[model samples]
Target: MIGSILGDIAGSVYEFHNIKTKEFPFLTPQKGYTDDSILTLATADWLLHGGDCATYYFRYATRYPCPLGGFGGRFREWLRQGQQTGQLRPYGSCGNGSAMRVGPVGWAFRTEEETLKAARISAACTHNHPEGIKGAQATALCIFLARDGKSKEDIKNTVEAKFDYDLNFTCDGIRDTYQWDATCQGTVPQAIRAFLDGTDFEDCIRTAISLGGDSDTLACITGSIAEAFYGIPPALHAQAMHYLPTHFQQIVAEFEEKYGPKIH
Candidate 1:
């Protein structure tokens, strides 16, 4: 989860001012965490309560409305509707929002089936579109596989076969032409590619940001997988934790305590 938060904070600044290279600073004075981390912690909170994710997701967004990590237009509207009317309906979006909050599902479940099922249930709250659901499931599966000690090649092949995403494009190849697309189909594979190609956790984030699409979402998804494959450094983890509010940090700690290897 810190991995996902760090990636969100790292890429939030670059979401618009894309640098297109992996040579940027490793961030100083971390930007406030965005919808990504907020929703992720929300998902963890939902898991702690053993209920549907959408309830807590909207709850957290309304409670912690940070403008720094901007929400998508549709998602903003969804939150507004829920807050005003207290009635919820799926927005029929295939956005990467589903994938951004899915890291906890990967960590909390033990089996591939459990991970995929939980991912689908969580995603159905908002990203019920098939591509949206696929993105969340694929990401959770990747994290699960990596934590389960599957080889990168094995992970890559399995994800490709299961999700049918074109994993052939390299970040360097896509960096020049990638546009700001939020759809899961547009975002997830590239994020996964960054993780697949990276040499380490930091490299995975740099690769995702360098792709220059939806920077925070791309890096957030990549960072979760990177954390599973290459555990976050303690200092780096502490730094990201420092950027979050105390309550959010406590949720992360509690989630890990209940469902983590704690220190891989």
Candidate 2:
């Protein structure tokens, strides 16, 4: 989860300004946690306390209400309606929003089946479309496998076989042609490829952001897998905490305590 936040903050400045290289500054003064981090917290919050997924998601999103959250149009509308009516109904979305926020589900569960189940629940809150659910499940499953000590080759083979995500392209190949895309179909495979190609957490995030498409979400997905495989550096973790609020940091601490990769 902290990994995902770090990616979001690092990629935030480039999401709109748009860059195509990994050589950019690690972070900018304007960098801050975005909806990816917020929704991930909400998912963790829900998993720990036991509540309806949409209810917790809506509750936390309302509390934060980040206008620059980078939510897709339909998701933004869903949030608004849920805030007003105290209800959230799935609107059949296939956006990468479901994938971007699902990192915590991988950490919170013990078994592959459990991780997949939790991922489904998390996505069903808004992204009930099949592709959206697949994206979330695939991401969560990758995190689970990586944390459980699967090799990158094994992870790639398993995810490709199970989810049919077509993880064949090199990040280098995708970088030149990749445009701003927010769909799971367009984004998740590339995010996975970023992790597959990277040697470490920072490299994985740099790889994702360098693709020049939906930067925050791409890095959000990449960081989830990278953290599981490589763990986060202490300096990087401290750097990320500097951008998060006390409330977010508090939950992050709690979740880490319960699910470990505990900070020293």
Best by lDDT: 2
TM-score for each model: 0.97, 0.97
Native RMSD of candidate 1 (Å): 1.2
Lowest lDDT 10-residue stretch of candidate 2 = 64-73
Prediction RMSDs, each to the true structure? 1.2, 1.3
Evaluate all candidate structures by whole-model CA lDDT and list the values in order: 0.88, 0.89
Q: Candidate 2 versus the native: TM-score?
A: 0.97
TM match of model 1 to true structure? 0.97
Q: Alpha-carbon error at 99 in model 2, in Å?
A: 0.6
Q: Give the poorly placed runs of model 1, Cα more than 4 Å off.
A: 261-264
Rate residue 122 of model 1 by lDDT.
Answer: 90
Question: Candidate 2's residue-wise lDDT over 65-139, tens digit each?
Answer: 863455567877998897688778999999999999999998988899999999999998899999999999999
